[model samples]
Target: MKPTDYINEWVNRITPYSPGKTIDGMTKLASNENSYGPSPKVIAGLREKIPEVFRYPHKNLHVKEKLSEYCRVKPENIVLSNGSDEMIELIIKAFKGPIASIYPSFVSYPIYAQIYNREYISSSLNQDFSFDHRKFIKDAWKANLMFLCSPNNPTGKVIDVADIEEVAQTGKIVVVDEAYFEFYGTTAKHLLLQYPNVIIMRTMAKAFGLAGLRMGYAIADPELAEALKKVRGPFTTNYLAQEATILALKDLDYMKKSVSRIITDRKAIEKRLAEKYKITPSYTNFILADVSPMSSKEFFDRMLEQKIVVRPQPKFNGFEGNYVRITVGTSEENFLLLDALSKV
Candidate 1:
């Protein structure tokens, strides 16, 4: 039999996720990575704990208690994952139901469906990239799992809590991926007390500058958190990641400053780039701009040639060849990108 016969039908049909390329000495702004470096405390903590690698991580993962303090939830109400992507996969693996999310959000949501062989569904966003709230509510009733990406990836649009609460009130499982929560400044965690169905997923990768460490966690009802733990690996969270995340969370002021700096730079870049490219108000660390007169491929190629990289938009969903997502880099890096754009 051919190799085709060995492949599972669902896995074969799903397209794999392609991450942005990394090049040495390139002014990288494509992947939405935090431009700011990690906190002093995080670096120090990681170094101090380096000698402890000979042993397995603490069995209970008491870092959950620290996370509980930061998130204002009890330890049992939280579940940690290798990264937010793993959390999404685990949820789909653990729960048995129809999964639904908005189109053009995080691309990984659909991949998990193929891996677990679960039902996956998506509702397209409006032309302006806003959700059709009425249609979403109607669909929520039928779906058992709803994956919501607030401060959505690529588009950078924020979701209203009122809209989320509407679906949560219906008893549908609403997993809000607030991976960009630091950038957005609001969360659905508050609704969890009344709505046991609300599952808020946050990551240390963005604000904490621990993307390399790969730490992400979910805040959910205590019972739901327990169920997710049953599907999670005993030590999916590494010792370094857990330790660094705790240090980062405790040094809140340091992270807050980094966040403030990125936000300031985002606005500056938007104002200058808006003269040529149409930009939406970003609630996240990246800005999506309409770069017409140049195809997405052409723009991406030109930027790469100049050693300044930005994200290219594919014509998936309703996107044409005119849009590109640019991460909000440091002021110097942003200037370098703007200068490269001028040359292109």
Candidate 2:
């Protein structure tokens, strides 16, 4: 074995998450990111906080207080992280067992399992790509961690609250990622009151448009929340992010306007794309379409040729190479992609 063979067997097996490819002057719609920016208040918040950057932000009690009020969970029941991704990693470390998630969902769930050298388990989605809890109910009992993405990535299907409760009943710690919660208009956070075992993961990326700031958090049983803090260590949430998110949460109007545009545009794109291809109606800010006239790879290349970037879901678990996920962008950006698809 070579010197690098010192790596753990699981680490050796993991394929790291690939970000959407970047190209100069391209209309990007691959990462499911909100094309809108954070509240204008964030700019002022940053300017006010920049002078204090030299000081380490002590535990962010004030920010947690704001999040608690927003999520309607007690402050002690929350654990803040750099992003929802960090919260997932912390959950893996704290739970320290096999990671299970619905397949062709978020690719990162299995990737997180590999990074921590934990077992990764999954069950395929229905042929329509919608979730069905009955398929994995038995396997869930065997798992220590369960990552459920509501308004699921790529597919944009939001698992029903009843479906989430069924998985929570299996006794595994259920982490419901609500990264696109604002778009969907439903939350499993109510499950927290019913199930002590549930963990609702949230981020400021999608609706709040704070992806660059890396602010995400979780709401869980107070005991589990405390455990996450121990695993998360210290200072992962830097000063600017903590303050900016607090401000962003206060400006609900900005989020509403941003989400409104995406939802409106999502329907518009779905309507247009449906005329030519099979497209999934979505709750999140993206649409998954079957691009059967061309291989996903060919379609991706075709879009790139038009200076647009879209995600081909075949790279994700359970996809069979005829699907692509297109993010809902600004009107002009969406028009560019739609126009390109018409020609391609």
Candidate 3:
């Protein structure tokens, strides 16, 4: 038999995640990447540290220490990864005995569960895409790990604090993915003090503008953090990425400016889309537009023709229907997307 026969059933059963396209020869608004680049200090730090890459990363101090100081968590409470994507994998690998996250949150959550051969129990969102914790809590005891993405992807909505606390009280490990936290200005990091089962993940990809560097981390209780560490491969984060992240954190002013711009631009985009296209508002760095006027595939093709790329969320096999997720971009790029939409 061929090697394909040897593959695990779950591996064969899994559907690969379709991410936002990179802007190779076009302006990309498909991924919610920061329009502004990373901090100036980050570039300078990388340049200064280039010579040290000849040696293996120290892996014990500096980067973690800086992160600890910035996040106000103990150094032992942190686990570094190539990106928050790896942390999602680690959580599933470490604690997923049966089930994982509900549906329509991060697409990767279910993918991670499938990779671990766990049964994914997907709870759907309401008509408005806001999470209903009551439904998830009712089924919580069945899962050892539960993934919650605040300011959830695609829908760009968040779960309230009270709802998150109730889920955390269920005694299951809760992985709160705060990938879009900077744009929304809310987080469950504070809840960790009361719930040892809670783990908050943050990424440098979105607001921090380090998507290329692949730096992400998790903040959790010391014991749970150690459990995740056991599953993570050594040196998942490289020496340059670590050093660049340190500088990313050091230049607080630069990060603040970028976040401020996103917040402002997000509001403007919503206001204009509402007035012009009659579209609804989104809470995260990206917005989901109802594509009922045209087929999602057709609309996506039109956008591409205008040299713009956006993600079309396929409404197939129990997934939401007729919607596309558009990332918030720079003022000029955002206008270009609007211009394309107006024409179509």
Candidate 4:
């Protein structure tokens, strides 16, 4: 009669996600967070809403309305979640059949699939880490739900809209994670109009700099949106998050300015890193470097010695050689990162 004996066998198979490490006084470029931080208006709004914590969060109609206006979709076509992570799980819960995605993209697609005991399938990215839509479609033929990340995590490469439309043609539920859409202005939202099964997941964590608030949303056809709403918890998004997100949406200029800065810094880092390592072209706030001569672990350790933190990509299905993901930080932080790399 051990508690372990009662745990589901499938749940036991899952390897938990390991987040980026945090250490005092280190320049953190491991996690892809917006180092610029959230807008002052959002902070003020959160302060005003603090006294109302005694009350339960409402149905989130206002938040959805505001998001709808921002996304240019009807309120009924939107569903709010604690973060896009929750939305991924909700999509798993609300759908049936195997989950499919590109190998070595977002780790959560397969992680959540395992949590729910759904079959998971994947297609390998090309040697250069570029996606091959035709190959993926054929490989994922058995999947009924597919997840695609644009300006994909770690690599920061974007999936072209034409490729996404090719996947959507299969009539499977297609979820395009646009977490870094602000950095790369291209969007697959136009596909949503033609394909009722297409869903676009977004978050305020990046350009809006509200990673602490964990606010995210999805835009799909009204019927599909309603289904997701039913599967999610009633109060997953709290009042503070709602208020803060509303304010963030209203302050688009602030978000754009931050994105512009990150984009500029991202290019600078890419240019500098390319002088040494093989740099992956990025459309997001991070760059993935092929530190081939040195093991990723060794590179991480060297960066650590310099009081800098960078993410070492674990061996995923299609990844070869050693690679590290470096988030674009503030100008000072980037300078420090470059200086540290010089020493390494």
Instruction: Give lDDT for model 3.
Output: 0.82
Off by over 4 Å in 3: 276-280, 316-321
Model 1 TM-score (2 dp)? 0.96
Candidate 1 ranges with C-alpha deviation above 4 Å: 2-4, 319-321
Local distance difference test, per candidate?
0.86, 0.86, 0.82, 0.90
Where in model 4 is the C-alpha error above 4 Å?
A: none
Model 2 spans > 4 angstroms off: 315-321
Backbone atom clashes (below 3 Å) for every candidate: 0, 0, 0, 0
Tens digit per residue, CA lDDT, model 1, 145-227: 98989989989998899988877877888899999999889998999989998899999989888888888999999899999
Pairs clashing in candidate 1? none
Model 3 Cα lDDT, one tens digit per residue, 1-344: 88888998679888898778886888898878887879877887788888888988775478889889988888998889888888888888888566656567788888887888887887777766767788887766588788888888877878898889989998888888999888888889999999999999999889889988898999999998889889988878988888888888889799888888777887877776665343546667788777776777887898899999988877834644578788888888878877887777
Better of 2 and 3 by lDDT: 2
Question: Which has the greatest TM-score?
Answer: 4
Best candidate, lDDT-wise? 4
Clashing pairs in 4: none
Ranking by TM-score: 4, 1, 2, 3
